[model samples]
Each structure stands twice: as structure tokens, then as C-alpha cells.
Target: MTFSLVARDSGTGAFGIVISSSSPAVASRCAHARAGVGVVASQNVTNPALGTLVLDALAGELDAEAALKAVLAQEKFPDYRQLTVVDANGSTAVHSGPNSLGVHTHLEGEAAVAAGNLLADESVIAELLGGYAGSTAKAFEDRLLDGLRAALAAGGEAGPVHSAGMLVVEDVPWPVTDLRVDHSDDPIGELAALWALWQPQKNDYRVRGVDPTRAPSYGVPGDQ
Candidate 1:
């Protein structure tokens, strides 16, 4: 019911993940990531714990493959879950539930991982992976979102997608930015619109570069 892509920006060293699901608030449960740490997307019979466990393993000095392997090794029902891991060094790996509706596969590349269950077609995942691999930008967040957007454009999850999210963290206390569109009839469109709200400038004010807590100084020193 969920599809996701996780990748590290080759140029900025930033890591991020983008996700969408037919389930409401899917992101709150399906995605987990830490900047400079690692990224994990656990869904379709999600272990939930795997999300944090994978992050800890990578952050605690384990490689991506090792971290993912350890998680798979201990799963009592690995055949029912799908997961992706991307370590601090940009290494990527993925595993899909063997029982996943007959069309799941992992697509791994330079600094990214794309995987899904109950997809419209395997080509959707391939298209997403290709988008990530071909990205030339410096922001992993953007790349991840672009991958998901591409997948959505190609037709997502087998069914309708209601919730979507983009998550990225830094050394900062919280995620640099965490955006979610819950229960939207058109989640992808909602997500794109949300990104535009955070885009650099509009109305002579900018949401970019300013702290979320800072009030924007819109007009001028002398206003009507």
C-alpha cells in the first residue's frame, strides 16, 4: 500500500526519503530517516521497529547492507515486509516481502533505493529508480520527491494514493523539513503545492532560509 524512495545527495551529503500510501497518515508509520544517519521505509506488514532499528545500526557504524541483513535475519516474518536502507556513505540496499502481491522488486543505484509493494506495475518502481539515478541536483530531499513524483506520474501503488510525505534531517534537532499531505484525493498534487509554499519567494517574502518561528517582514518601513 506504500511506495518510497530513499537516496543520498551525492553533492551535499544530505539523505532523504519520499513516500506515498493508500493508507491515511502513511508517512507517520511508513517512513523513518535521520540526516547523517540512515533512511528506512518499512511497509506492507511493516515491522515499524525496523525503521528505528535500521537507523541505529547504520548510525552506530554498520554498513547499509549489514544493517539491512541484520534486520532481515531477525524478522520472524520477513516475507511480509518491504524495506530499504541507505547508509551514511551512500550505499543502498532493499528487500521486499516474498509474498508481496507478485510484482515487487528492488531497484538500487549509486546513492538511492526504490522499492514498493502492490504497485500498478513494476515499471513504476523502475521509473522512480531511474529518476533518482539520473538526478543531478544537490538536494536528496528534492531527488527523493522527484522520484516519487515520477512514479506517481507513471501511475502509483496499484490503487489510489491518499497520503504522501517527504522527510529529511540534518544535524539539527529535528528534521530539516517534514511535509505530509494526508488523505488527499490527489496526494501528489497536494505535495507539489506544499513544496511551492516553502519555495524561496512569493509576495515579497520568503519561506526559504528563514526559521519556521521567524515572522516575515513583508512590506517596507513605510506601509499604508
Candidate 2:
């Protein structure tokens, strides 16, 4: 029901995840990333907790493979979940439970990993990784968006995807880009548009968080 890509930007030390699914609000549950840490996508049975577990382990100095193994060691239903992780060093790990939903597959690429359950075919995962590889020169968020678009073109989910999300973390503790299109007819396109709109203001939002005194006006009603 879901297809996702987790990747690291070698040029910028950024981490990001792009996901789309037949399920509503898929990103809220399946994608997770922390600045200077790693990225994780937990799908299939969709245990949001696993995303945190993996990130926490990575934050605790575990490599991607070690972090995933640590989480699976405690995961009671490992056979029912599909997981992928990419660490700050661009190392990756993935696990697909034997009981994962139909036609599940996962693959690894340079500084990236991808997984999907109930997908149209293996082409979906291939295109996802391929897109990331081809678009390394693009902005981190745009590279992810291109991967999601390629997933759609390759075949996408077995069913119509209702939600899409992109999460990207850069030098800050917070996400540089976090966009979700829950229950949209065309979630990927909606997410792409949101990224475009957020591009100019991305830094400003971070500024507001890190230093309100240096932040600019909100450009809304009360500003004089």
C-alpha cells in the first residue's frame, strides 16, 4: 500500500524521505528524519513507533544497519513490517517482513534505500532509486520529489494513492522541508507544488525558530 525512498545528500549532509500510499496521511506515519542523524520509512503494517526507534538508535551512535538490527531485535512483529533506513554517513539498511503485503520489494542505491509493498511491480522501486541517482545535482527536496514522480510513472501502488509526503532535514535540528498532501486525488503533484511554494520561505521559517529577533515580518495582517 506504500512506496518510499530514504536518502542522504552527499553534497549537503541532508537527509530526506519521500513517500506515497493508498493510506491516508502516510507520511505522518511512515517517514521520519532528523538533522545530522538519519532517515527512516516504516510501511506495510505501518508502525510509526518503529520510525522513532530507528532514529533514536541512530542518534545514539548506531549505524544504519546496526540501528535497524537493534530495532528488529525488539520488534515483536518484524514479519509484518517493511523498513528502510539511511544514516548520516550515507549507509543504508532495509528489512521486508515475510508477511508484508503483496508484491513487496526493496533495493539500495548510492546513499539511498527504497521499499514498497503492494506495488505494481519491481519497476516502481527501480525508478525510485534511479530518479534519486539521476537527480543528485538538484536540490535535496527536489531530488526526492523527482523520485516520487518517477515512482508514479513506473507504476506506483497497487491501488490509488491518497496521500503523499516529503521530509527533509538539513543543518538544523528541525526539518527544512516537511510537506504532506493527505487524501488528495494526486498527492505527489500536490506535494511538489507545496515544495515549490515553500522554497523561498524555507530559510525564513528556520530563522523564526532559531532566532526570532533576526526573523522578518510574517507578512500577514498585523505587520505595520
Candidate 3:
């Protein structure tokens, strides 16, 4: 009961994953990415460990397809999982297991790949892939949001998607963007709004971590 996309930003070499699902906290278990490595999404009776395996292989310098193949080869029940990977170079790969739940399909485009199961229709993944391809957003996060919105517009999951999330990793070891809407009637929209509100502080959070001297002070009352 999930749909997701993994993409690499050509301009900045960032990796991002955007996902939504009928289940709650999908991102917590399905989406994974690492700075300067790659992005991976694992669903359809997800084994969560598979996501980490893909990222680990990518960090070892494997290409998108190679990483997925290596990880999937070890899966005891590969036929029950759906996975997608995008490497730092923008190469993409996807796997939809034979036993994936409900109507499931996937599509790939330059630097991006999308997959969905238990979808409203086959058109859902195509719309998400096309939307990301057509987006002009300078930021990977915005582009991902565009893709998720497109999926929703095209009749997202078979039921209401209660959780939505965006994950992005830039040059830093930590995620520059990691936002989730655990339970919402409109999780995708809520995720977008949260991104907007978080945009200005994205860099600030990083600065606080690596260079507190240059970090802006928190405006909250306790800092005085």
C-alpha cells in the first residue's frame, strides 16, 4: 500500500526520496538515503533491512542497478518486495516482486524512478514519473513534492494515504530535508507545507552542526 520515487538532482548531486502510503509512518520503514551515496525505497511487505543494504552497497561505489541486484539477490523472498534505487550519478533501477500486493507498477526516467502497489490505477506511477520529469523546481525537495502531488492528482493509493514523507541528502552526512506527515487526510499537501516552512532553516540546522560560530542564534526565549 505504498508508492515512492527515488531521484538524484543533476545540478547538485543530491539524493532524494518521496513516499506516501495507506499505512502510517511509511517513511520510517521504507525510505532510505545517504549523502553522496544513493536513495532507496523498499515496500510491499517491506523488509526495511533491504533499504539499508542498498544504501550500504551504493556507498561502497556500486551503481544503482548493481547495488539493487546485490541486495535483492540475498532476499529470501524477493518476490514479495518492491524496491527502487537512484545513484549519485543519476542512474536508476527498480524491482517489483512477483507477489506485490494489489495493482502494482513502476516507471523510470532520467535520474528518477517511481513505483507503487495497491494503487488506484496503473496511471498513478506514470503520472508521478512524468510530473517529476516535467518539474522545473531548482531544489530536489520541491521536485519530489511535485511528483507526490501528481500521484495524488492521478488518484493516489486505492485508499486514503495517511502518511507522506520527503527525504533528501546533500553534501552533508545528515539529511538536509527529512519531513513526514504520519497520519493525515492530505499527507502529501501537509508535507509540502512543512517543507516550505522548513526551507529557510534547512541550512541553519546544518550550520549549527558543523560550524556553530557561523550559525544563527535561535530566536526562542531561552537563548537570551
Candidate 4:
């Protein structure tokens, strides 16, 4: 019921995840990333807490493979969940449980991993990775979005997707980009539009967070 890609940008030291699903607000549960840490996509049976669990392990200095293994070691129902992790060093790891839904599969590429369950076919994973990898010249966020688009084009989930999202974390303590289309007939398209509107202002928001005096005006009523 879900498909996702998690990636680390070696050049910028950023991590991101792009995800979509037949379920509503899929990303809110599946996508997770932390600045200077790593990114995780926890879907399939959808143990949302696993995202945080993996991140915590990464924060504790575990690499991608170690972090994922540590989490699965403690998870009560590991067989029902699918997880992907990409660390700050561009190392990647993925686990698709034996109990995962129809046509499920996962793939690891340079600095990235793609995973899905209840997908239209196994090729979706390869297409997602290929799309992201082929767009190395693009912005990290755009590459992630491209991956999601490619997976959908190759054939997404077994059913129509209703929600989609992208999460990115850079040098700040919070996400630099977090865009979601909670429920839509064309969630990925809506998400892409939101990214277009947000891209130019992304750095501005980060500046506002770290130093308000140096930040630009909000362009609202109170400023002179």
C-alpha cells in the first residue's frame, strides 16, 4: 500500500524521503529524517514509531545497516514491516519482511534506497532508484520528487494513491522541507506544486529560524 525512497545527499550533507500511498497522510507516518543524522522510511504494515527508532540509532552513531538491524532486532512484528535507511555517509540499507504485501520489493543504490509493498510490480523499486540516480545534477529535493514520479509512472501501489509527501533535513535542527498532500486524487502532482511554491522561500525560512534579525521581512502587514 506504500512506496518510498530515502536518500542522502553527500555534497550537501542532507537527508530526504519521498513517499506515497493508497492510505491518507502516508508520509506523516512513513517519512522521517534528521539533520546530521539520517533518513528512514517505515511503511508496509506501517509501524510509524520505527522511523524514530531508526533515527535514534543513527543518532547514537550506528551506520545505516547497523541501525536498521538494531531496530528489527527489537521490533515485535518485524515480519510485517518494510524499512529503508540511508545514513549521513551515503550508506544505505533496506528490509522487506517476508510478510510484506503483494509484489513487494526494495532496492539500494548509491546513497539511496527504494522500497514498496502492495505495488503494481517489482519494477517500481528499480524505476524509483533509477529516476533519482539519473537526476544527479538536480537539487536533492527535486531528485527525490523525480523518484516518486518515476515509481508512479512505472506503476505505483496496487491501488490508486491518495496521499504523498517529501521530507528533507539540512543543517538545522528541523526539517528544511516538509511538503504533503494529505488526500488527493493526484497527490504527487499536488505535492510537486507545493514544492515549486516552497523552493524559493526554503532558505529564507531557515534563516528566520537561526537568526531573525538577519532574516528578511515576512511581507505581511506589520513591516515597513
Given candidate 2, what's the lDDT at residue 140?
85
RMSD of 3: 0.9
lDDT of 3 by residue, 1-224 (tens): 99999898888998899999999999999999999888999998999999999989998989999999999988999999999999888898999999999999999899899999999999999999888888998777888889999999999999889999999999999998999999998899899999999998998999998998888988999884
User: Candidate 4, clashing residue pairs?
Assistant: none
**Candidate number that wins on TM-score, 1 or 4:** 4
TM-score between model 3 and native: 0.98
Give one clash count per candidate, in the order shown. Answer: 1, 0, 0, 0
Q: Which lDDT values do the candidates have, in the order given?
A: 0.80, 0.93, 0.93, 0.94
What lDDT tens digits, residue by residue, belong to model 4 across residues 47-86?
A: 9999999999999999999999999999999999999999
Residue 163, model 1: lDDT of 95
For candidate 3, which ten residues in a row score worst on lDDT? 215-224
RMSD of candidate 1 to the truth, in angstroms, is 4.0
Candidate 2 weakest lDDT stretch, 10 residues: 131-140
TM-score of 1: 0.86
Q: lDDT (0-100) at residue 2 of candidate 3?
A: 96
- Candidate 1 vs candidate 3: which has greater lDDT? 3
